[model samples]
Target: MTNSRPVVNKPEIDFSDPDWKRHFQEDFDKQFSLPHLRDILAIKPRPTTFSLKSRIPLDDGDGAATGSWNGYVNDDDRALLKVIKFASPTSAGAECIDPDCSWVEQWVHRAGPRKQIYFEPREVKAGIVTCGGLCPGLNDVIRQIVLTLEKYGVKNIVGIPYGYRGFSDEGLSEVPLSRKVVQNINLAGGSFLGVSRGGPSTSDIVDNIQAKRIDMLFVLGGDGTHAGALAIHNECRTRKLKVSVVCVPKTIDNDILLMDKTFGFDTAVEEAQRVINSAYVEARSAYHGIGLVKLMGRSSGFIAMHASLSSGQIDICLIPEVPFNLEGPNGVLQHLEHLIKTKGNAVVCVAEGAGQDYLHKSNTTDASGNVVLSDIGVHIQQQVHVH
Candidate 1:
């Protein structure tokens, strides 16, 4: 008897084989032929082209399109989706004016050549610290600067604690930054670094920056902070330390010069309006005649003036820049009387900076360690009620 052994021949398997294309094509066709995918692929691409006039057409009785349609034909059907897709990262899919919604066309007409970035990305080595009072968009400006710098392989960032106090002749209290640390910080209120009334006028601050060897310093604060950075810059330039100082203006007082619209001013205005509006309502109800509301501002009348303008109910506004004098017949007293007699009701907006020219000053200090503003509103209110 002869023992029979089964013959086994290995089936050839070659990933790089020429016939692999056919096999892969067959598998792809079969896998992608699922009912759901078939339905999606079956949809005829939507039309995106539209025509519009250079100007809006005048409305005649009949609603027929009639005008020099300005030859404004959108030839690029893919432009809208491309723009929308580009903006989606920042806008998060909010409605935008993109002409093309087709992903295929967008891919074809993309702005730049597609390539993978392979260089080991480096950090920004930049740091921002807040000082004094907190402000709005402090986090936003910090985040934007970080993000922009990050794209250029500079991502190393730190937040100096408690403003410049965090950085002193001793050293910088550093918080290492990464994509994870500052993510989604834009449009946030207050400062991520947290602010304090520390390091107002300290030479040790500049010494701290030098000791830490901070590549770039972004100071998120007000005039004092700006002055601190400026002083440091001057010293650095004088001694050649190569430290770069940039300032992001922020304050509730809005007194800082050069920059327009600091962070907290918007919030301050909204808050002041609420207070003024409520006071006006109460004045009307109590028949207290009028409420002379005092809003915050040391050197700037921005807050008080804005409150009156925004609160339409407030009949008159008084700012520090425009002094209130009662010695003459054409004084503020006469002005309020005129408004009361004509408007039936009056809500006056007065800046805290507007001192009492006729009355005595008070001995008080606010939370910021500044002298408290005298309440001219009370003096005016008293005199008006007496008369």
Candidate 2:
């Protein structure tokens, strides 16, 4: 008599507990073993002895050297272009036989073509050094550049240890890179080479670039970093060095006008939107509420406005460029009440530097002593008594 029910092995498994060691091992294995199609096509053999010179031997009518050698065997330089082949030394003569000669024509034809392609594989070494503040896609860009340059027959590209600071402090070292040097770095956050917070001036950066023989320099940072890059470009021009300089915009502020979007802005906006949505949900649950989400935007309304618009939970958005008045008939309090009386829940996004107080009291100041404004989200929320 057997029971038809299947027996289960109930082993005690604590899935709730964080197994960091297992997680790390799994991630490490996945990262190292990952396959890429680009790596296969990039593997090309480097030349061994590329400096061998192929000189053409000439035949004189009376065994006298003519042409550019001009009756001199040691002149060895050829002005007239001719192709010749080496023949086995005869006991009677010490001369290289010309291929046109029939006696050794068979041997010359077997020696292959006279035009030789010299494969002088000079190992190209490059490095990426970043300075001042962290940008979102610096590491990703570094990875792409290294991979792309390798495909361009560059064998030795390195990471400048630290930023410009390391060149002065720890000195410089050639960072050996393979596919392994920048593996899984595209998904990485922050600079993998690590950046310096110190903004090196023009002269110091140029000196470092020249001292290191840096062929190309990629500078990733905000306005100050961009200014530093510009200074470096100017200095390089003044010195007549062929240092190719480029700048990658890496600010979360989204204030750089030349670039459509900086790397960190998307991340910043995403985080702000998430927080605003969460706050809206919490405020909605309270049922008698209005929420004021103060977001970071010192000079631009991009972050505050984008977050508010994306969430669709915020009814009002106040930016730095647009002035907000909390005392008027269509004031901050009036907006909050309007949303609440109609929708029962109100969310407002306010830029941290949104111009004056909502009640129009004090004034804000930027680094350049320009008048900025206080965030109006909190002021409106306070007036509405949002719990």
Instruction: Name the regions of candidate 2 deviating beyond 4 angstroms.
Output: 1-125, 161-164, 170-178, 356-387
Task: List per-prediction Cα lDDT, in the order shown.
Answer: 0.60, 0.59
- Pick out the ten consecutive residues of candidate 2 with the lowest summed lDDT: 104-113
Backbone clashes for every candidate come to: 11, 2
Find the candidate with the highest lDDT and give its number: 1
Residue 308 in model 1: shift from native, Å?
Answer: 1.4
TM-score per candidate: 0.61, 0.58
Clashing pairs in model 2, backbone N/Cα/C closer than 3 A:
355-373, 356-373
In the range 183-230, model 1's lDDT, one tens digit per residue, is 877656667777776453445666666667676788877766666677
* Tens-place lDDT digits, model 2, residues 75-102: 1222211223324433223232222221
- The TM-score measured for candidate 2 stands at 0.58
